[model samples]
Target: MGTLSPAAPPTTPERTKSRLLEAVKDCDCATAQALADKLGVTVPAIRRHLQDLQDAGQLEVRTEKPGGRGRPQHVYVLTEAGEATFPKAYATLCVDVLDQVERLFGDGAVLRVMDARRLEFQGVLASRLAGHSDLGRKLTALAAVLCEYGYAARAYQENGQWYLTQRNCPAPAVAKAFPQLCQAELTLYRDLLELPVSREARLSCGAAECRYKVG
Candidate 1:
């Protein structure tokens, strides 16, 4: 988002749109004005690109409560598909190791390895989220850490229940190759949050996002 040279209007819409998407994802520019400033483009031009991205299902808007008067503020965030536009940093080497695990040992040994990884992550998450006694606060803290871990996670409330959704999986190949990793991941969340966390959707099952509900 630093001093990006602006492209001329509509002529280079694709290039401009690509830059705009990067601004939204990396710079967290939720507003048209902010995106314009970051990309060195006009507000109206930015708005057009924003609409195009939204129509393509790459981004979604959330209308937050108004701070003062007037209408609520609309903020845009990347959808799972949008997150897919970026490069994934998962190590294929891990997948190779996991495959060897299944070959040399048995299915039980593979589950044990994934479980061990889950336990380590559980300890890290629990320690960071320890001070948040309330369920909502704990969920929010969990989201922050998940994002840091490249999960692109969000925490929100619906129907008086807290939810966690991850748009990106750090180890997509590992998850796809071994169902045990997915199960271990669910177990980690339940154990760390100390609640009966139920999975509503899973990326492994062809869902765009992986969703969990706190009960």
Candidate 2:
């Protein structure tokens, strides 16, 4: 006799509702029509799902007026509750550990940890960047590693300059508490690239992205 296969997990009342929630997660904010178009569903059906999620505290709605529009559009954003449904790696935990280390030891101890992390990051980058003779190729490999660690990173060339930009910061909490993290990363890139990698902006500094360029 053949053995029984494992059963599939139970789903919510409407699978489309889950998709709608994910849509908001992806865009960070979306309108009913946009979600409908993305999921290939009717507007009315999408509204129902958005309403249900809002009622259940899974989303928040905001009103936005288009530059040229007859009616203000309703935008949906995932609430803390909705965000909880997705997979996450809490960088706050890293902040907590750093706090404990600072408490037990001192600021000097935390700085040392930052230095150690700089070495570790350098090692990882060096391994992947091996044999990448072109500067663009090296930055592309570095971008891949950063994305794997949750920083949404991209490498590109513009105006005859090569740049690495990170749109998302994986460890905001840690970076906020320990400015050393930023400094250490800066030092690491300089050492590894053997060139001056100037930082044009920083996400932690409220800029749109953390940008580094070879000049």
When superposed on Cα atoms, how far off is each prediction in RMSD? Answer: 14.3, 18.7
lDDT of 2 by residue, 1-215 (tens): 99999999865557778888888888633888888888888899888888999999999999987665668888899899999888766777788888899999987899899999889888988998899988888888888988998889999999999888999987777788788899888888899989899999998989999999975
Query: What is candidate 1's lDDT per residue for 87-206, written digit by digit as tens?
Result: 765567778888898889987989999888898988898889978999888899999999999999999999898899999987777788888988999999888877898999999789
Model 2 local distance difference test score: 0.86
lDDT of 1 at 93: 79
Q: What is the TM-score of each candidate against the true structure?
A: 0.58, 0.58
Off by over 4 Å in 2: 1-89
